[model samples]
Target chain A: MNSDSLWEVFINACLINNFVLAYFLGICPFLGVSAKLETASRMGVAVCVVMLVSSICAYFIHRVLQALNAPYLQLIAFIVVIASTVQLVEMFIKKASPTLFRALGIFLPLITSNCAILGVALFQTNKGYDFIQSIVYAFGAGLGFMLALILMAGVREKLALARLPDTVEGTAISLMIAGVLSLSFMGFAGLG
Target chain B: MQPEKPIVIRKEVVRRGSADEFLKGLWRENPVFVQVLGMCPVLAVTNSAINALTMGLATAFVLLLSNLLVSCLRHYIPPQVRIATFILIIATFVTVVDYLIQAISLEIHKSLGAFISLIVVNCLILGRAEAFASRNSIGRSLLDALGMGAGFTFALLCMGGVREILGGGTLFGVALFADNYQPWVVMILPSGGFFTLGAWLLLFNRIKQRQQRKQPRLQARLQEMGSEQ
Candidate 1:
């Protein structure tokens, strides 16, 4: 585990293989909350924190499920764990930072079904990463998601004033921008 | 404790015929384009027509069955446990579909991979089960599910057909262009999925906008004719 090298995991997650652009995870929030830069960054932080915690929990329970030889339990266990973790995180945020809570509170429940958090847990287990590797991978995935969210939010802010055609005003234009962004993310395909 | 009160509620609550219920999903409440629910498959499996079709069928099946079951059990399931029960029901169907796909065709199963299971988390199925099914009659719930399922399938087919034709230079499997035709290439990739859906959404929105613009013109012309008469 010590020799696995965390840099590769970080790079592989953050840039080489992004969650939103590459894997198509967290796209609902990617489109919904990305209308404002501040909101996007807040949601990104919330997702990052939840992803980290869910990864830790998923890694441990996964071992127990493997020992019990109940492979089918993976979906239910991961989802329940993630839902509770989001609840826990939401409470903590409410107590710790009221202002931050206000910004991210609404999106907190939405994170339970984000799929990226669940995707992190599932993919890390699939790759058979060690405990430390799972943590780093989760962190990387979160940061990658955050980066994508921030970038899209910035663009959308600028687009607020642009005069797009009536039909392509909101979701349509956002998707087109995301498509082009996904194309750009493909440039990193050869890095790793 | 008779079934008469429930029937009154059903009759009063659901005024529209089944056909109206079904048509809404196809156009106004389309799961893909209009409501924009279940986008993961909308943008993912649409790289090919056959894959998209298979995925559409699987989702529709799960959706139709789940809606039926949820509607039947709505009165039994307490409101507190409704979400969990819904999740469990959805996961069961997804697992069944996952295994059934593997049994039917290993290649298609392999192609779909984790996404087959991810259908459980799709907002569309849960959204429908919660929003429409839980409160409505079983017959109406069935209509809603079928409409949504067909609308979702129609949207996927549209995306898949365009992507397959442009990206692979083929409709389903047969080659359409010449042997030397230079395919767009990008259409088959992940990015191509985003591009194709985005373009289709743009087209749909433009058509909708044009119609909205015409409605006012027609109204104004009617008023002018009324004054002249």
Candidate 2:
């Protein structure tokens, strides 16, 4: 795990094992916020920022937890820190862009529950990636997530105008499209 | 006579209401098929039946315990910090379950990966905590947790069962078909998870639409019977 270069880690996290499409992380916001391209891009950016911040926090916290010899508190510690970070992000976003904040809505706080963020925290710790590797991994995962969300939003926008059966209209169609996207992502398996 | 009739009706209504609370999660408002609350575990760990069932049970355990704790402390927890407090309680339980699963079987633990910890993020559990458990009584929340947990398990099994059968030509590692039976390898991949869930959602939509179509007819027939009586 530690032998891989930063580029390999980035590629592995971004395209080969894309968070949303490949690992099934962050599906909630991926589906819920991807309805509009504008909102999706904003949400993706918000998530990317949160991921970057929380990833840094998690790295330092993990080191502290290790020094303290209280590994069991890792989950609780990570979550509490993530929650606080999200609160900060929420306030920042609200001040910077109220429309974006409103558009993001509950999902902003709900980012606390976005598994992709936590997954990065946990995966980084588990994979034993050092400081730089962890940052690159988070960046790659965030990029992958944003990429997936933007692509999904674009597809959904087109899908809205196309005629379709009632049963296949909503989440079912989205999942089907996501499945195809995931299949295409699988083609990147050899890249890393 | 009227007073007595009203009392009996009220008692029956209470009984039915309690039953509804429990029964609704099993089918009507399933956490997965209907509400689509937690998609990570639903898609991530369900590549095999055993993995799916284990994940389901682990999630149910967290959901059940968290619901119990949240309802018990509902009043003590203020509105502002309730979400954080709920998460703290949930993360504690997930940590416990994480170690518990690790102790039980390292291989299953490995297969489940960080998902055991990710239970903290499963919207279904937190949704229940915020939406149902925090507002409801202890007994009611307990029933809700059980029902939702069972429903979650049922849905995971549905996905796991199909995927395993088609993907591996086996159920719970037991080979069911002859040597020549070919497995659809895609059925077990990440994309397969999406496809299987989409298929399930489509089926559920169809069933719901059919039931809705029959509902008015059934209501009219009932009204006609009442008039005749």
Top DockQ hit: 2
Estimate every model's Cα lDDT from 0 to 1.
0.89, 0.94
Q: Tell me the DockQ of each model, to 2 decimals.
A: 0.65, 0.93
Model 1 stretches astray by more than 4 angstroms: A1-5, B1-15, B219-229
Q: Per-residue alpha-carbon lDDT of model 2 for B1-229, expressed as tens digits?
A: 6679989999998997798888999999999999999999999999899999999999899989999999999889989888889999999999999999999999999998998999999999989999999989999999999999999999999999999999999999999999999999999999999999999999999999999999999999999999999
Please state every model's RMSD to the true fold in angstroms: 4.4, 1.7
Cα DockQ of the candidate 1 complex: 0.65
* Highest-TM-score candidate: 2
Off by over 4 Å in 2: A94-106, B1-9
Tens-digit lDDT track of model 2 for A1-192:
487899999999999999999899999999999999988998888889999999999999999999999999999999999999999999998999898888888778778889999999999999999999999999999999999999999999999999998989899999999999999999999887
lDDT of 1 by residue, A1-192 (tens): 235578888888988889898788878999999999999998999999999999999999999999999888888888888888998998988999998888776899999888788889878887889999999999999999999999999999999989876777888889889988989998988877
- What clash pairs does model 2 have? none
lDDT of 1 by residue, B76-143 (tens): 99999898888888888887888889999999988887778778778999999999999989999999
